[model samples]
Target: MVAQQHGRRGAAFAAVTMAGAVAGVVATTGCSGEVGATADDRPAGGPRVVREAADVLLASGSSKARTSMEMAAGGTRVTIRGEGGYNFAERIGRLKVVLPRDPAGASEHRPITELVAPAALYMKNRGAGVPADKWVRVDATTLEDGNLVTGGATDPLAAAELLRAARNVTFVGSQDLAGTRVWHYRGVTDIGEAAKVASPFARGALNAAAKGFAKDVVPFDAYLDDEGRLRKVRHRFSYLNQGRTVDVASTTLLYAFGSAVSVQLPPAADIFAGKIGT
Candidate 1:
């Protein structure tokens, strides 16, 4: 389970996954839009609606941060485990990922891969000159693919769809982050899906780790603060590969809003792109 990027985009998926999660990229829905809640939407007496802090939102532009993730998958008899790290800034980004070799079944250990980039993600194992399409758009910055909207138009949420799909959300509440109050929630996720989105690691790694993981049992925690300004998340994942079990766990923090410390959107795309790379 070496940590290398495949496909045209290499580790861009992992970069985007980390960037979006730490940035609190809230897609601006229509003012009159309605939100859909999960079965656990009602959380006893938690804060239903929390106000976004203006200063915190503004500071989210191009903030630098780091993240570490762990994952494990398997069933009944076998399991495997791995860990990943990411560093994100408006101008540059880097990721280091490592996974177990045999997990609990075999005796092979996996290798580690490091990715560094300014604009595009690098897949060291896949060779150079590969285009990271999904991670780095060439002509124009558009919303991420698979984002659902009324007119099928590209919007912020479209860019954020990558993160939203990482887990199954159940409830959304409110909490304090960076001194700002925000909305928080919890749910479940398919560890495989999230790993692919966040690390650019292979899916087979998760499958191999899970001897019989027909169902996903990963737990997810998130906080959407500042009226969609910033979000913080944590994931608890486990899997069994071969005859052993490995545990991968991690936490993520993001800031999205206000100003850019690094990237400046095109004049025409500025408003839509919001404040980024400050």
Candidate 2:
């Protein structure tokens, strides 16, 4: 039963548990990589280009997205996937996230619908005794990882914004992705620095993540097209869970630029106000 006195802490903890369940499944394969030219051979303004990825996406409007969040711990690995579209200018997106099946493959879980808006995250079919039709909402800024990992799928726009603080960048060489030629770049981004330079809508959440994550430095590999649009990006993150550090590799792929995206937030009456079970 849901409790009437639910608060941010309970909601945040519940979201983390949901994410952990998705991450806890067993699987194989680690984050993929591509080898390319050395940093010295990188093109001019490599770092500057990487830092401007978020702005490029914003200018381009909306795009369809595919997301993958992979976690490995105790020699066990699992991956959660999502498909959706984002309206960058409005800072809103929607995703249908699918968790991995049981190790035995006997049963599959239902997909969860997630609505991401500025400073908030909403989910349906969250499944811990909450009604199927009721949605659970959490303040993005209150989440330790800033809802980056808590939602089981990173917000595509926020992921791009994270690159705003890229440092020590290098061109990893050119690669063809899904028939498009893209320039590959690798670098490390500081969450604190990004928070300072990120858009006003994302500043608070990034600030929270800067302090919540075990380390503010996140290593990443990003790909961009000729027009400067972000084609793909993979961010490596680590956070403390049960006193153990869990490694997560989150990948976001964007395509079909200028796509139409519609996200409708649930009304107050439809939002579950009761305490979520752990």
Top candidate when judged by lDDT against the true structure: 2
Instruction: Please name the candidate that would achieve the greatest TM-score relative to the true structure.
Output: 2
TM-score of model 1 (CA atoms): 0.37
lDDT of each: 0.31, 0.79
Question: How much is the lDDT of residue 140 in candidate 2?
Answer: 81
Estimated TM-score per prediction?
A: 0.37, 0.88
What residue runs in model 1 are displaced by over 4 Å at the alpha carbon?
A: 1-62, 70-92, 95-163, 166-168, 191-217, 256-278
- Report residue 159 deviation for candidate 1 (angstroms): 12
Q: How far is each candidate from the true structure, as Cα RMSD in Å?
A: 14.6, 3.7
Instruction: Put down candidate 1 lDDT per residue, 5-25, tens digits, no spaces.
Output: 122222222222221111112
lDDT over C-alpha atoms for residue 208 of model 1: 27
Model 2 lDDT on a 0 to 1 scale: 0.79
